[model samples]
Target: MGDGSLRRIAALARQDARLLARDPAPLIVRTLMPLLVMGFTQPLFRAALRAGDVPDANGAEQGVPGMAVVFLFLLVNVVGFAMFREHGWHTWDRLRAGPARSFELVAGHVLVALAAALAQLAVVLGVGGALSGLRVRGSWPALAVVGVPLALCVVMAGMALVALCRSISQLTVAANLLALLLAGLGGALTPLSVLPDWARPLAPGVPSYWAMRGFSTVVLDGGGVVDVLLPAAVLCGFAAGLTVVTLVFFRSAHPKLTWS
Candidate 1:
């Protein structure tokens, strides 16, 4: 909107970034855990491919990209805690008392989360490729198209959680459940084709499902940017819809009470 508001959001985002960097738990959970999971699964994926059992996946490619989708849920939970962290530290009022509006504060969290999610996804893919000998076999930019939307969706969803839940525990429980349920139903835990008949139709509805499909199109099919455009558009829609919902929820909420 206004230049002042833009400046404010940027400054606040920087502050939020500092706070996030200082937090070790989010670092371990968001950054390290996904890499660890991918590393552990690489051997299994390699074996499956050799046996001609893991359909549509060649060695570490499937398992590695798969981890990116799975960790998105975890990223949402980690980013969603930003509001609670401020609330716990009793800094929300201070921000609100100054030039910051609730939107400003929420936007800052969104910015930080967005950047973090993108970086986190890259780390997972990078570690998979470097340490586990994973290959892209397709356009790197195409993969980024999938990643951008996934990151946006997580950030928007996390901001919504900040508005909806009152306490860190409440937010954590709800976000984790949501992340896990989406992962389970959306083919992050397994392939969509392998899912039961009844679940097939529903799998397409989840954001992560689109992410997996897009990734597979690029990595497994050796498809290009044009092929991934559909899933990229789908993910963008999810991000936009979640953004609207987050705005509405955060706007209607009185931050002082919501934070409490």
Candidate 2:
């Protein structure tokens, strides 16, 4: 809040952005990998559709949105991994030792993750537009409003993971496992309608599900801006709650640095 804190946050953001730009692997994986998967899987799903295997409702209409959700998951995972690596290598310690506060650290990492998420979103949208001929039917501004909070949720989730993890390997394994589970439950790999009745209740609990539904409703379902309000609010709450939890976890883990 103070000028010093604001300057520190700005510095950290600039440093993180430079590091992210220098490393192209995570960028490629986060932005392009999902597009590739969608490209390859579209034909398989189409064939399944023709053969009456995957069901018609689970075809392009549902699949495209679901794939976009998966791409978002990839973006979250990449950011999580990058954060884990930086924390493991003591980069976070160095930053904290500098002018950066805990909030600044979180903000900087979230900013970097947001950049990656936006790039990933653009790639998915481009690919979906070109290949699947997908179109956004609702208001673009509303979609953008919904997307910003969702990306923050993802970044906070990554921070929570970094705070909870003791080692890089553990962080990597946990991140991947959680990403896979959330993606599956959130209709990334399959449509929510195709899920069992008992599983219906669980979808709303996963962050990715809200993100996917919010985006699809605004972009593909021609829904009103009000329709996305609940999901966007939920994602914002998720981000805020997880941020508090991450801060507490970090404080507990590094008691010596509590006042640093």
Candidate 3:
């Protein structure tokens, strides 16, 4: 890409960041809601971990990271909503007619979403630890290894949804369904060791499972960067696959509608 194109994506990313800042309620709410939920569920998580043979395990070890992963996946929908809102506001064509390519437009959204997702993860983990005793117990760099790839997966998944969905309603339903389904199947809702035998095999297919794997290794087992490499690589594979799907299905001229 040329310097000019880079500049355009940067400019659009800045604009999108500003727009996101303008409506911080969703971000604030997601952040606070997880903390509140952990308050009520940490004991339960601790009990489950104890039952799993980690007799000394505090609930925060499971509660904090699990809830963070769930919310992180939930936040993926924001990317789709942001992109679809352009069409709702009748601005997508105008933006399309501008100098930026469709790829650049989507790139801008991806950049913003990636940043927001990372920040959200950091905030949730940090505060949850401070308030709920969720310690890292391992390498901070290892945490980043898991977090960055997970964030990339989220943005790519959002882009894929935007490519596939034609209406706001469809996008909303798909994004939410995928978020919940992926989180639940991936063992974010409960530990993989505790899941029924038939469902245990399905967790590895979802990005959230790798994320939780990396996180649990760090937060619960004191594992370092080396321990997380496999999960990180798997997350990158998921992100790459989603990117291919988005590229294959997305078209600059595709029309989007706000279902009434």
Candidate scoring better on TM-score of 1 and 2: 1
* Per-residue lDDT over 1-260 for candidate 2, one digit per residue giving the tens place of the 0 to 100 score: 88887777777778778878788787776666666677677765555444543344334555566676666765655766666556556565676677666667777777777777776676666576567755567876677667778777777777787777666566667777888888888867765556668777898998888877887687557777798999899989988998888888864235221111
TM-scores of all predicted structures: 0.90, 0.85, 0.97
Model 1 CA lDDT for position 164: 77
On a 0 to 100 scale, what is the lDDT of residue 214 in model 1?
91
| Alpha carbon lDDT at 6, candidate 3 | 97
lDDT of each: 0.77, 0.70, 0.89
Return the number of clashes found in candidate 2.
Answer: 0
Estimate the lDDT of model 3: 0.89
Q: Write the per-residue lDDT of candidate 3 for residues 61-120, one digit (tens) a residue.
A: 888888998888888678888988888888889999999997899898899899998988
> Which ten-residue region of model 1 has the weakest summed lDDT?
251-260
Candidate 2 error regions (>4 Å): 43-58, 87-92, 252-260
Q: At residue 247, what lDDT does model 2 achieve?
A: 85
Query: Which has the greatest lDDT?
Result: 3
